[model samples]
Target: MSQTPLQEIELYAFASNSAQFHLTPHEFDVDLGGTVYVSTPIERNELALGAEAAKSALELKLPQTCDLVRHLLANALTGDTTAITLRIARRDPWGDTWWIAGTRWMGRVLGVEVADDGARVRCESAQVSLKRIGLRRLYSRTCSHVLYSAACGASPISASAIVSGSTGRSVDLDGGVPGSVSGGLAGGWLQTPEGARHMIVSETGSGVELLYPATIEPGTEVLLTAGCDHSTATCASRFGNLDNYGGFPAIPSKNPFSTGVF
Candidate 1:
């Protein structure tokens, strides 16, 4: 069977020769070598400038006796390494555009391209493991799940989970064989006889967070299967309720943008 298209992907960029540039997804730019001239959107320019200023400030605050120039150069080299690693992590089953500096992961992929014209990601298989630290707040709010496939190549992964708090919600899984409560008030890891795992949180007003395991290396492709009840009260109110009957709603099988194929 052919693979489904990817819905979302992460990109990383490494500065080669102090290259100055901007990236999609976040739409932020950076000056690779030193400050140069460029034209960019006001918002993007501000964000980029802020990042550069922050880095410069850190460089200045280092030990006074330290060789600041050497330190700065070393840091820039380190940053390039990080960027390349990130870029490599974004590889899918298809061709990828990333520059590997060393064994360390750095670099950023700028855009995403799908195999099919407009298909969205549909997870086929995945390997899940528990994390030492649970999911973080941003992951819960932005990407609650990840979906992958074979045909997509080594350039992209799908949706990252976002945090969404529940409101007086509960559900009985497998027709009441297992019951779960929402509202960020459910805690503990719930395991099924069939071998699926779930980490439950019971703190009031907290959203469930998802963490992408470090084992999910670059160039590996796996599909994601998200439960239908993956919406917060706020999200449901803003975007129509995603629940279909008693089951979690299926994620759209289409990309949100037409340019997703790239």
Candidate 2:
């Protein structure tokens, strides 16, 4: 069948950019990029800059029963929600294939509010984050860098381990599981070759609790990274990279400048 020309479809791409939820304010499913965005009741506010607009915030009202809402609810409480982002893009059929004609809003998923009518997905503009940042880093007790990230240096987490067991939302480590409080795998993460990553919430001798609901097969190979409490002690002792710690732990608790009583 021939598709509508220059459809005003909005696509929400999330889940590490692996999943796409195609939606249109229109009453029919529109095929773009060879994917079908089913028809749904959507209310999106205008995206613009000026005094009278919610410039930095984008809100989408979607049915509570929709797949995207269910997906957000499942991963919202369990995992690091920041990695899950929502991109609002308008697309059109470009002759042979579809193209992202324009992007109205793109940013990290801030939160979701559910009501009897629908679920509201709130997102902050990607630029808003840059505006809040200062020229220099702030003082803190822990390292500011993310684990296994480029700024964390090429520092790698623990070695890969064969899955000894699996559960609906957890995994049995090949060896004893250390809790996050104890500077173990709890605050770290596990990654598969297929690019599936689950952050460890807490760990015990039994297994590691992951943020997502998916389970790993017993024979699947997974990589486990050690967690950091971001304390100076953990930096010196565990990773032995205290020099790279982001926070200024030595900052005095009482600010003499404010007190005028140093």
Candidate 3:
């Protein structure tokens, strides 16, 4: 079939383990390169040889109203590797919808630059080969229960976890499962009624502080999930989901003194 001509582009960012977002950019530029060989004296006028590896980079100038830029900044501050998808779309002559070609890659936010002219935000990122890296835990294991929210196929709570009180930075919750909600769920999420998600930083008694302050009204219905510290016992006992555990619980904690110098 004949393909339609290119018409538009769409960018999406999935950061901090949340849902995807459609990001609008005022200026978007991409650099695509490949590793090639060329010697100065011998092949000065000739093109480089065939490529062995590929490299890609993206730079965007976006409006300050775009929240994805802030999300990218937060990810940068927290050392998160988030995946970004860029779609090249073509207007289908036969229909109203556009046909899209997508390139998905994991990348880090290299920098976030601000301009004095109006409220424009600029950022740079480079492609990451996530598949090339082997599977490993990003953080050390803890004994807390793991959190699997609705986005991860965990069932929704019937009762409202939100209560009618807040300290502008913290929220009090009610109607949580007796043993399910606790301090162990510190890093989990609480999805608000407006579909915005906030991360739980620390929990004490009935109050929970978010990583960043959020504007949530009183009596709003919210959903809460537990957070896991990636321990074997918590996986098996608390969540009963040990089959999916990927950590080495039996690994030695001390180095092997094979030389016997001590």
* Per-residue lDDT over 1-262 for candidate 1, one digit per residue giving the tens place of the 0 to 100 score: 9896543332333343444332323233323244321222211111123323222211011121222222223232123211222221232356532222322122222221122222111111011112225643223332233111121111121122222222222222221112133332232222223323233333222233221111122222222222322344423442243332222345555665964864
For model 2, where is the 10-residue window of minimal lDDT?
A: 77-86
Off by over 4 Å in 1: 1-85, 88-169, 173-186, 203-262
**Best of the two (1, 3) by TM-score:** 3
Total backbone collisions for each predicted model: 53, 1, 6
Ranking of all candidate structures by their lDDT, best first: 2, 3, 1
**Worst-scoring 10-residue span by lDDT in model 3:** 35-44
Residue ranges of candidate 2 with Cα displaced over 4 Å: 1-9, 13-29, 33-54, 58-104, 108-122, 126-133, 136-139, 174-183, 256-262
Task: Supply candidate 1's per-residue lDDT for 237.
Answer: 41
Looking at model 3, the pairs that clash are 145-228, 146-227, 146-228, 147-226, 147-227, 147-228
Best by TM-score: 2
Relative to the true structure, how large is the alpha-carbon lDDT of every model? 0.26, 0.63, 0.49
What is the C-alpha RMSD, rounded to one decimal, of candidate 3?
12.6
* TM-score of each model, paired residue for residue: 0.17, 0.61, 0.49
